[model samples]
Target: MSESKSAKSGGTAGSRAGGTEGAATSARIGVLKTYKLFVGGKFPRSESGRVYEVTDSKGNWLANPPLASRKDARDAVVAARKAVGGWSGATAYNRGQILYRIAEMLEGRREQFIGEVAAGEGLSRAKAAGRVDAAVDRWVWYAGWADKIAQVAGGANPVAGPFFNLSSPEPTGVVAVLAPRRCSFLGLVSVLAPVIVTGNTAVLVPSEERPLPALSLSEVLATSDLPGGVVNVLSGRASELGTPLAAHQDVNAIDLAGAGPELARDLEIAAADNLKRVVRPAPDREPDWRGDPGTARMLPFLETKTVWHPVGS
Candidate 1:
């Protein structure tokens, strides 16, 4: 590639030479747009046929992902519900292996991701790289949990008489997650792993503004042999998808976030219809979020089930 082309395509869509920032999207520069939603192990447009432009932090056109409609949301919920039983039935050790592969894929793509975020989110090279690295590390942390959460949250129970009782953490069937409005990669993985680690199938909607990495994460999930539909993801307005899942009879729980108060209210009210377990709102959430969605997020989505049987004389 020539020096000019190389400069335009190197990393960020803008240059910081001589401490001056300039747009790299001259008509002559080559660019591409992404336009599809990852669903049911395939990429397709909204059934209602809508599309929206996504811009990099530089405002250069990045892609036009499908503007998933309510029908699309219903379809994704069907996918999640379909896979819940098989996913929950998988042995914990096997589940751990597949989740660990996600960590491996993320580690391999660390630099590319750092560069993407650096260019896409306008963070300095160092900060972007750090965020990418942290995101990968977070995946590894949760990978370990796939085989261990039960140890931490489940155990043998003491019975009052000559009877036996055992309490164990189990998948709550299908889950719906409204990813944080900030911190795309880390928060996405944090929210997803815990849901699936317990054997729950999740239908995750990425933050509208920063859906690229979420789609990329879906790519990794696809390759990792997570049973198709075990962890479905969509990139569109959360409001467009949130309401249906919060109230969907098949979805056992919903993790809420993205935007502000109005979105929260809609989710809470929708969830009330089913008494669906819901994750509450956070302060100033973003599309580039990072935190343990397990303790705080997963706990609420999960329920404690105790089995009691009597050994009588």
Candidate 2:
């Protein structure tokens, strides 16, 4: 009887171990996602075929986003230049419609953004959600501005002695923007929307540590009828791409919001090569993107042209 009991016990133990092994084998391991750059409304891996790992705040593996190179920056500039005329020539009302469409799409995908922001920024769910909500509302705000900026900033000038004099604000062509590093979503939209709202095509380099949200946002822009090339997003180290963008003669303007003091100065000097319109950060003072970002941010990329004609008899 004792020998038979021992055999049964050993058999039961063996079955239990086998069951554990099967469970382990069946466990699901998440497939790591690869995020690519958004250029000319298309998703493409870096021309260099290189990718860098992006980790969460706690050092947890998040994704491997494409590491954009100087070549990518130049390509983005070319795309932006191609898109400039059509986008800038569109009616302001049409631009407003498209901007509003972005808001609508973002609304539909709010939860996804909230989760991304939470993970990317190391914020609580509630706080991250708040950031997403603000970002969506920012689009709505800029949508309204799209149709109103001209009225507020351009008009018939009352000249001392002129037949008919009018001042018009026009987009400054292709703009390269280095988005702020800390406030990934909000800061990005705050700078980007203004540039494009005025009808300028943009090449945006997002915050390195927090690029996932911007990459996801690019997906929204791609489907939102904003037109390809109007907004191209490159995700990688800003240091690698900034100088090339600044020095590119085809690029008409740049926003150095992401560069450190020394880098910002260097880029500003390079921008002088082509006389690029640069918006440099203040010394040791980062502009608060969350607060009301009035017309001050939008006016920099706009050029005012004055036209005068003799009064018709």
Per-residue lDDT of 1-313 in model 1, one digit per residue for the tens? 3335434442522222211222343334334435467677777778988888776777866566778887888999888888887889999889888888878988876655665566566677688777888778777777787778877788879989777788888878888888766666666776777778778888889878877778777777788888899877788888878877788988888877664678888788888887788777675544345544446554565678898889788
Worst 10 residues of 2 by lDDT: 6-15
Model 1 earns a TM-score of: 0.87
Model 2, span 203-260: residue lDDT tens: 9999999898899889999999998999999999988999999999999999998888
The count of residue-pair clashes in candidate 2 stands at 0
Q: Candidate 1 overall Cα lDDT vs. reference?
A: 0.73
lDDT of predicted model 2: 0.85
> Which residue pairs collide, candidate 2?
none
lDDT of each: 0.73, 0.85
Clashes of each: 11, 0
